[model samples]
Target: MNKLWIVLTYAVFTVLLIIPLVKMTTAAFSGGLGALGDALSRPEALHAFMMTALVVVTVTLLNTLLGMMTAVYLVRGNWMSRWLRRLMNSLVDLPYAVSPVIGGLMIVLLLGPGSAAGAFFDHIGFKIVYAFPGMVIATLFVTFPLMVREVMPVLQEIGTQQEEAASTLGAYSWTTFWKVTWPSIRWAVIYGVVLTIARALGEFGAVLVVSGNIINRTQTATTLIYQDVENFNVTSANGAALVLAAFSIGLMLLMEWAKKRRGVH
Candidate 1:
């Protein structure tokens, strides 16, 4: 029975993951390495990748800082009322519950050009909707939960005893965080950052809706792939997908390495 289960698992994995990866690889290379290079070297493709890198870096940094703060507050803020903490905790998971498309639409509704906030920002010469800022915001919405979720459990598990001890020993709050709290949650923060990067890289719906997929301005790698497919440029789409897949695979390996390091520690 165990042998049968093992075979079944492999079969399922191959069918769902391996086969598709193989197919994509084949398709991406169908026109040879020169074609793949050409596809990726196009002006639009270069811009799309650069936009994606910007979003990923910005979102990851913001999410890591804010998410860790939020998790610490939720877990350790004695000043917060019980109900308030509960409310905040529930809100952290809102992105996971809500569809990304809906999240994008909400951004559009709240801050698009027609809305008051959007108009205000636009009048101030800072466009939010259908621009780079909007893309970052949308990606942030989709990826925020990842870091919070990763850090919260670690904070809970490590408890506040050490932090309290540090404070009692005359350490300032910032000192306590750096000396007593940071080391404990560092791995969790790293994990959250990796997850945020991965999600931001592949995010399509929200970014598309918010960025308007403007070429050379707000286009991301995923949206570029969508545009390519829509234009029946299958080769270009395949090449772009392969690049994303390569990044994802590298992240996966890094994640595994981190997991092993955490385990050893």
Candidate 2:
């Protein structure tokens, strides 16, 4: 029965994942390496990739710092009442509950140029919606939960006993975090970072809406693929998608390695 189940699982995996990846690779290289390179080296493609890298770096950094802080607060901070903690926990998962498209629309409505906040920012010579900053914000909204969820469980499992003991021993709060808490949750943070990078890389719906898909301005790699498909440039789209898939696969491998290291520790 176990062997049968394993066979079925492999069948499912091949049908859903392996076949599509194979198809994408074939299509990406159908015109040969020159075609793939030409597609990726186009000015617009280069800009889109650069924009994606920027968003990924910005979103990953902000999410890592903020998500870790939020997770620690939710799990260990004594300032919150039980109900408030519960409320915050629910809010942290709000992104998961909401559609990325809807999340993008919400940002547009709240911060687009027609709105008061948007107008204020615009008046101050800053743009939020339909720009680079908007793209980062949209991506951040979609990926924030990944980091928090990863760290929260580890924090809960490890508990605050060691942190308290460190405090009792005259360690400063930062010292306690570095000395006692960080080692336990560092792996979880790395996992969260990997997840955040993957999600940010592939995020389409939210970034699409918020970015306005402006070429060389707000277009990300995923959005570039969308644009390629819309323009019936299938080969180009495939090349871009293959690049993203490569990154995602690398991240998956990194995650597996991190898991093994974590287990070793």
lDDT of each: 0.94, 0.95
The positional error of residue 242 in candidate 1, measured at the CA in angstroms, is: 0.5
> Per-residue lDDT of 184-248 in model 2, one digit per residue for the tens?
99999999999999999999999999999989888899999998999999899999999999999
Question: Can you give the lDDT of residue 122 in candidate 2?
Answer: 96
Model 1 per-residue lDDT at 38? 96
- Candidate 1 residue 114 Cα shift, in angstroms, is 1.0
Per-residue lDDT for 166 in model 1?
A: 92
> RMSD (Cα, Å) of candidate 2?
1.2
Residue-level lDDT of model 1, residues 70-168, one tens digit each, is 998998888999999999999989999999999999999999989999999999999999998899899999998899999999999989889889989
For candidate 1, list the clashing residue pairs, or say none.
none
Q: Looking at model 2, which ten-residue stretch has the lowest summed lDDT?
A: 73-82
Off by over 4 Å in 2: 1-6
